[model samples]
Target: MTTTISPSRKTNEAVRPAKQPLRDRLVRLQRRIPIVQLALLVLVCAYGLATLPGFGSWMSIKSILILGALVGMAALGQSIVVLIGGIDLGVAGYIVAGALMVTQFATLNNVPFGVAFLLATAGAAVLGGTVGYLCHRFRIHSIIVTFAMGSVALGLAQLQVAGAYGGGAPVWLTQMTSPVMGTLGLPIPPLVLVWAVVIVLAALFLHRTAAGRRLLATGANPRAAELVHIRTRRVWVLAFAFSAVASVVAGVFLAGFAGNVDVTMGNPYLFESLAAVIIGGTVFGGPGDYSRTVVGVLLLTVLTTVLVGQGLTGADKQILYGLIILAAMAVYGRERRLRDQV
Candidate 1:
């Protein structure tokens, strides 16, 4: 006579062991994702220094910081949208608006830069708020609303300039973004310093403010947030408004960086911003932070610089970006929505 296990016992044993493996796998994956990204950044940097001429040169390094700052600034806004379970496709349009604003209002018309900047940011807030309101009120996905809003913004911007969007930034502004110009003689671009300051402020706003907590709560679970009287719709409105304003700021500085402004000046940043946010391990509906975005920005900049040094064509770069995004998705896509965790 042999002892026999009950069906219930067998089921428990089998199911428990199965779950442990899955749980272990998930834990390992969570640990590996960030480490892998950082490791890749290091590896890419090493490869660049070894194989790419001028990759580690002072000018090249400065170029990387400036380029990364632009992308990081744009991605900063995208991070807010993603945190709130939304995406802002209108970033490019708002960037154009800002660039055009500086060109038309400040440079061409000779309005003061400070006044022009305020007007541009205020207008962006209104447009972005409207986009958020429509999405919330109508229960529409942000992708559709923002895409339409972006097109409208672009058209309006073009119409405003009457197809004559051409101007140079003020000389002082240009110097501010120049690679040779240092912050307080510290050998760092002023634009880079500004980016660093913005990053610090953003991190503080997200982690230290009540409003920031509310935004995170809304993204984690809108219905739950509403049940708790969090006013998620308002959060949405403010989030998108901030997104627009951030894009505008980036655009203005970017105009200075390039010394000129155009309606299409912000086109490339559209996808790059979203790509950086995604690559930064920030999932939709919360569960991410600005620090991750910083790492992602650095990685992307270094990788892109290396690729460019290798003489990759535009088409090839696009293809590579697509593949990199897909890889990031594979790693982070499986995360449970923050709502579930909540």
Candidate 2:
């Protein structure tokens, strides 16, 4: 007689392994990565509020919101371009250009607030579109092209100023953004409202529109996207245009806040926007969420505020920012590899 396996052994052999749900698998994978950055950011914000005198005060909060809002808008735009497998190093340049447009209009032409804002925004968009065209038509890398464009934009702004403040902005533009909306002892800055609108609109555009999906697909695989009849070049152009719009909006807001335009107003934001995008989990030329970008911007704003309060110089802040971005990239790289393997 042949040897027979035990009933328990047969049962064990017959039992198939349970498969994890997709959602569960995603959650587990997310946990494997260093996702604690978000929590850490929250903790840091709380610490800043508790330790820094007046840090939690209304004025401090308003200041953070206003600054964060402007930076967040630009970061959102940058994140979109990055998601589409491109980079726009021209954020600061576009911002400066936008601000200068408004200042020049108001100072020289005596343009109305509405007209100046529209002209500035439209001008920035055109600049962005031109950069996109240069990249697509010449088969140049977006990064190199945008970097050069940024230099040009910066130069133009400086040329306008010619070693002095660009005169001054219109009175109405200053008044519109300065007066805070007070509700029950809380001040809501106009920049905060602008930021909220941009975030919501961007989130919707990325998640709810077919064009957005096409952009993502183009970024994920341009060759495949083109094969599928998606106008990859147009998507690229649109991405740059969107980024320019963000920069211009931010510049306009800044103009209102500062009450005038200076060539250097946008210099600091170039790196800040990049940091915010990276820290928000938007990998370079990879999938990312705008909501996360917003959170990242807020986190950065808080960190910078605390650092300044602690007497850190601008150079020190820049160094720390660079380190943080590097750390985020490292983490993202590992996670990306893991995802590819899976």
Off by over 4 Å in 2: 1-35, 154-164, 183-186, 337-342
250: Cα error in model 2, Å: 1.1
Please give the distance, in angstroms, between residue 243's alpha carbon in candidate 1 and its true position after superposition: 0.5
Model 2 error, position 331 (Å)? 0.5
For residues 93-150, write the lDDT of model 1, one tens digit per residue: 9888887777765655678888888888888888889988989999999999888887
Superposed model 1: Cα runs more than 4 Å off: 1-33
**lDDT by residue (tens digit), candidate 2, 90-120:** 8888787777767765566566667767876
| TM-score, predicted candidate 2 vs. hidden true structure | 0.86
Candidate 1 matches the true fold with a TM-score of 0.90
Q: Least accurate stretch of 10 residues (summed lDDT) in model 1?
A: 26-35
| lDDT by candidate, in order shown | 0.85, 0.77
